[model samples]
Target: MEEEDEQEEMYEVQEILVDPKQKAVRIDKFVTDKLPRVSRNRVQNGIRSGSILVDGQPVKPNHKLSPGELISIVIPRHGDRPDGIVPQDIPLDIRYEDEAILIVHKPPGMVVHPGVGNPDGTLVNALAHYLSDTDIPVLPGNDNDRVGLVHRIDKDTSGLLVIAKTESAMSFLARQFFDHSIDRTYQAIVWGAPEPPDGTIERNIGRHPRFRQKYTVFDEDEGKVAITHYRTLSDMYYVSLCELKLETGRTHQIRVHMGSLGHPVFSDEKYGGDRIVKGTVYSKFKTFVERCFALCPRQALHAKSIGFIHPVSREYVHFDSELPEDMQSCLDRWHHYVDHRRANNQLEP
Candidate 1:
């Protein structure tokens, strides 16, 4: 315990070593070169404080030390840790691949990019490995398009996502998604059924009035135009299964639209329900959901099917990811319960 604490409380002090020809250089630059891992902000902060001493006295952030001056740097222990975003060799479930496009299955809980509190094991990192190993182009416009990443899905959302390998393909696919020509259908377990079994939500979505963290539907100028179409698949006592086809893909569009209608998705901590289930497949499902939720994760809302006009050939291209295991188990268990209850009642009568 003492060793661990000492290791965490690490600090350093460096003697000012200056070259005869390096006397004209700036202090911040000198510090930056000396400490390549430290950020510019930290160097500036250190200089402004008395922690950085020049010739055994405090100096401003801008002071350039002369050669032969004894500059003392009292490196403070970690005030903040750097977030390391190194690319790791992670496996990606690729559904379809070609020179023009690639369809991948993004697993649940893998964040699309490095963000606050999460700095590793992202979809971006996975794509990095895919590029190095396969030598495929992911870039759409520039050299970074070597991965030709066309669009992105949420960290938790899984299914058929298309990537463009070339600039032409990228522009074409971007336009397709923007114009809502691509057929994108998702299977969602929402809290309740819509009053009308099949309908469209034309409400605009913007930041919520009360909770800025979430999106809401209301008449506002700052909001973006959004639309969604949903059809009831199955109706339960407290919840329902529905197929959502996107007319316009906006941030949290499906989840927010359903929430605006008072029907958020199941196990959706952001919009609403985290209903606990106790059973067999559902027990495994409960564990799956709990694990997914262990890190602000929600139940996977899968893109069951996607159809689009081929960017290069003009012919249609379609792909699908079967309901992921956990969700499939939920549906199977729901049906099993219905069948068992119906047969038991019939036998009793």
Candidate 2:
């Protein structure tokens, strides 16, 4: 017989000082803007629970704070919070780790963290389990939330990711991402070739009509500004490999904008791409890929590199991950198809 195990984590709030230059800012909005990763719901929850204060008095979420006003915030440890971020030994390809930061290469199809349909096996869960034995100092009044989380990549995308080990680092890193100061490069397989080798695709992105699961560039509703720059790396057969640099990190920005340009991600069934390779253009190559390399399951997208200023050391650093097994295999087959077509002069422009 084995005894059951259980543990509890404590949370507390910390003091915050308002800057005179940031006066007239909405308190909740200010916090959300300052802590981009902290969800607005958590911020509101902290306010209602009296875990947050302005000038030592509990304030409503709608209240505005003056610059130079002292702020008292209580941030709870994540384990005790509903967000339930815990560390686990889920095996990570860590490129770098320090007392103030942790960076990993998240594989494709692995969710970043738990969300509505997903509640576990997240990067958040693994992080929590990894730090289960470690001590986390919480602020007195702040609610228990993700402590070191800075930003996120989608479940189906794989690449370099950064995690903050301290609250100070979290805030700084979040600002860098929000202000577009961070350099993130992504590799994608798109359809067709644009006129120039390198070009820009700037458009407003919003939800798609009739297709709620997808996004589009032309919309009747309000949308955020989006921009993507790409350079054609190779053009062979009907597909082209492109490198994308983002100017804005909107939901599905890369996929949607690429689709708008007539090139949805390969294997992307959501954004008008047929997962089946039955089209006349890919008939022969499809049979070859499906037989030789069946490893590539999802879209052939990857985060190739990320560079930023280290929040703790203040030193600039860059990190990169090679294409994972699946994408690598896909590229292998792609190379084969390109050679086959070129050898026979069957390739199209």
Model 1 agreement with the true structure over 49-159: per-residue lDDT tens digits: 444567767677778768877665544333232432355688888889887777888776666655577666776566666665666544422222124444456666766
Q: Judge candidate 1 at residue 208 and give its lDDT.
A: 82
lDDT (Cα, 0-100) at 41 in candidate 1: 59
Cα lDDT computed for each candidate against the true fold: 0.63, 0.67
Instruction: Kindly report which residue stretches of model 2 are placed more than 4 angstroms away from their true locations once superposed.
Output: 1-83, 134-147, 219-221, 275-283, 289-293
Candidate 1: global Cα-lDDT? 0.63
Candidate 2: residue 347 lDDT (0-100): 65
Q: Please, what is the TM-score per model?
A: 0.64, 0.73
